[model samples]
Target: MSATGVVNVDDARVAYRLHGRGPAVVLVNGTGGGDGHWGDLIERLARSRTVVTLDYSGAGETTDNGAPLDLPTLARQVAAVSEAVAAPHVDLVGHSLGAAIATVLAAERPELVRTLTLVAGFLTAAEPRLKLTFELWRRLIAVDREGFIQILALTTLSDKFFASPLAAHLDALAQGILTGTNWEGLARQVELDLRVDIHAEASRVRCPTLVVGCAHDQIVTRARDLCDRIPDATFSEIDAGHQAYFEASEEFAAKFLTFADGLYSPRRLSSSVS
Candidate 1:
């Protein structure tokens, strides 16, 4: 079973959950989502390694001062969680916005990060597609949240997923977003997404890093370039969409665990290879 707790970061109470027992691994969430989005991945990874998932300030169970979101502050929040849960260095995995924050953390607080895994994470706000998408997303959130979620689903999952019976889950997510969550927090995060540029910091990351790109991702088109900017970063592609972790959970977890084991447990790494 996972143990849940909260840590005070600045004025915010950052909520986190820890599970399993082995080398530590921290999973970060994307924009407008939290640790809850990682249920499937957590279940799989927690069996072998200690897994920590954090809810950013103003999202999930974490509480904040309701101030505008920024990369430095968000990165610090992640660092705090890592410091509290992990012994010394913890393997870090991030998706989308969480990836960006992880990059900043890996760069700024290199001592706390053992290895870094970035899934569908961009390094900067230079992508025209992302800029336009977030702009439209913010507008839709203010004017029509239901419509915003439907549109979000369009970009997150692939066409194959939409054709599957699981597509109903998107509707459920949309309904949850309509009734749950704070718009101010989301708006601040969207603004942070537009402004976050961790190129300088990401370039400084010296740890063994893996960049996972979605083959059919419609959201972030610059995953390749994002990897390129990082110093000696290894890149891999998943045959899914932006939400590949959800669309292809087994493949996603396999890729991540393979990389993680290679760094922390040579025995597990060799066993997996055999």
Candidate 2:
């Protein structure tokens, strides 16, 4: 079964979609992403589980008064959607910014999450490199939107991707990114990204968790740091960049499904991309 709806969260109208059936698996998107971004992964997971996706306050079909984005509020929005689903508990899969939100949720509301999977996640953006990158993003968005997207692509995608035949369609890819992006929303998310700090929450996460890192990721290089903070959390690395889910979808899905199904051993500290 498939359905779509919105959940009221403070001043925001958060949109969400449901696909397939069985155990619930909620997928949370990163900065500038929405429920729509999980199309491919949803297709793979939905075959065996009810896949849920939602747009944060500034992304996708979600809307809110122009309040500056914050981690607590964003996490609340995710919690609202999870509660709306009425599931006893759901497997939570979060990427990048979504991972931080998931960390907060898992800490504050452990009963809502059965298992947690954080991909390309980080403990905080207070690190010099991350802070500078996000600051640059804010400035670029204000002065040069096109350049901002171009730079984003360069940093998030691996060199291997650019060397592949798919590079011939770079123009189309950029155009799609340009058209699909919500500039104002993205700017707000970028602002939130700059302020993200979830170390305390990560340590409080008691649920089984998996932290997936991108070997070539230029963004969120501290994914393993997050894993170290969480008790018994397993760490895995994919041979791609920040956008590993897109660059290596099959491998990403396989790892995620294995963890979500409880087949993966938390004792295993690390796993390489197969």
Candidate 3:
């Protein structure tokens, strides 16, 4: 099934798509992220369960209206998408900045979330190294866009991935970013990333939570702090860097499916909906 629409929330028009069948899984993309960022994993996950993906305001097809942004406001946008797509509860997968938004939703609107997966999430942007990295990103976007893209690739991929045979695939990804990146939207997201603070929200998430960490992530580090803050949150570490999900799709999917299947009962959506 294919149904794509927009949900109005405050000043933003959030673009969303719901497809596949069985159970419900809502995917929230990170900074400058769109559903396509999930790549092959989307098709794999969609094969067995209904998958919902959305564009945050100022990203992809979503409209920002030039409104100022904050973490909660972004979370509200995600919450709106969840309400439009899921039933009583839906499993949530959030990566990077998306993780912060998901954390807020699971905390403020616990009933809407069945389970939570925080991939490369952070409790705060106060970390000196992470903060410095974001600052450098913003500066690079202003002075040298290609340099910024290169830096992004550097921070996202690990040394082992570089040695692997996926250089061609990763090169294609970098090319896509260079050609298709939304500079304005990305600049805004970089600002939001520097300001994200979800420690309070993390404490309130009561649903079964998984915290995924990357071994060589230069962007977001100290994953244990995020896990420790969330009560009983489980922790898992992947060998790749920040973009582990993309670099290690099969492993990430296997881990994700295992966690999600244990929490949600499969409920297929009919081909046609009223």
Candidate 4:
């Protein structure tokens, strides 16, 4: 739940958390959110690997000491996490914009990454309507944070998430997002968000990849088209939306771990004594 450790990178102390204990996995969260956004999904994959999630430069409890927040900068900050942890050939799992960053990292550092799993991801600047959603996020953060969270609840997750049974969870999710650090860092993230395309470089990924599209995503439709862009990609479909990580946690985990395991050669670890 907390960052496993923090280290200074340039002007910012990037905080990262590690889960599980075998091969490594790094999770990237959505806009204005942090590693915690992966919810139970990270917990599930940790069953067989050393999964790492981070509080981006200013997001989560990780505070910003003032660093560049542009697209390339954000991309490298994540790269720094891989570097700091000495993760050798990682499998990256990212959701929404987090998926975008994971793809960029896979593109630039193919050697460091063994595979990539993108959930609810995209190349929005490449989409006219999707770019408008980025604008709306800017307006909300600039004018109304709570409103942003409320609607984001609608956009990222599904109507089912807001339906009577799951409605109460909204308060808890809001608290997490509101309480996290990175106010200006998040804003800077948004500014840089407007300039890039998640799809532009999808074709560049050379590692084995699995792109999962939520069959009911409300935030970015055509998640499949985005998935189709990857050259060496495999695909799966979950019956949830942006927050499918929460909605379909178990199914997502099973599929993710299986896909990730396929990327690596067999290894031997010390046997657990029963």
Top-lDDT structure, candidate number: 2
- TM-score to native of every candidate shown: 0.94, 0.92, 0.93, 0.88
What lDDT would each prediction earn against the true structure? 0.84, 0.87, 0.86, 0.75
Sort the predicted structures by lDDT, highest score first.
2, 3, 1, 4
Model 3 agreement with the true structure over 26-89: per-residue lDDT tens digits: 9999888877688677888888878899988768888867766788888888888888874668
Higher-lDDT candidate of 3 and 4: 3
Pairs with steric clashes in candidate 1? none
**Cα RMSD (angstroms) for every candidate in the order listed:** 2.6, 3.5, 5.1, 4.8
Residue by residue across 29-122, what tens digits does model 2's lDDT show?
9998865455377888888889899999878889899889998898899999998998988889999999999999999999999889999998
1-274 in candidate 4: lDDT tens per residue?
A: 2237877766677778887788788888877775556667777877787888887754776666565565555667788887777776777888777888888888888888877888888766657767888889889988998887877777777666667576787798787777664568787777667876766578898777788888877777777776778885777889887778878889988887767664343552222101
Specify the poorest-scoring 10-residue window by lDDT in model 1. 265-274
TM-score of decoy 2 = 0.92
Steric clash pairs (candidate 2): none
User: How big is the RMSD of model 3?
Assistant: 5.1
Residue 169 accuracy (lDDT) in model 2: 78
Residue pairs in collision within model 4: 4-17, 123-198
Error of 1 at 125 (Å): 1.3
Tens-digit lDDT string for candidate 1 (1-274): 5798888989899998898887888998898886556648878888888888888975788888898888889889989988887479898999999999999889888888878999999977877888898899889878988888888888888988888888877767777777787777888888888897888888898877899999999998789887899888889999889978888888988998878776557555323222
- Misplaced by over 4 Å in model 4 are 1-3, 65-68, 198-200, 265-274
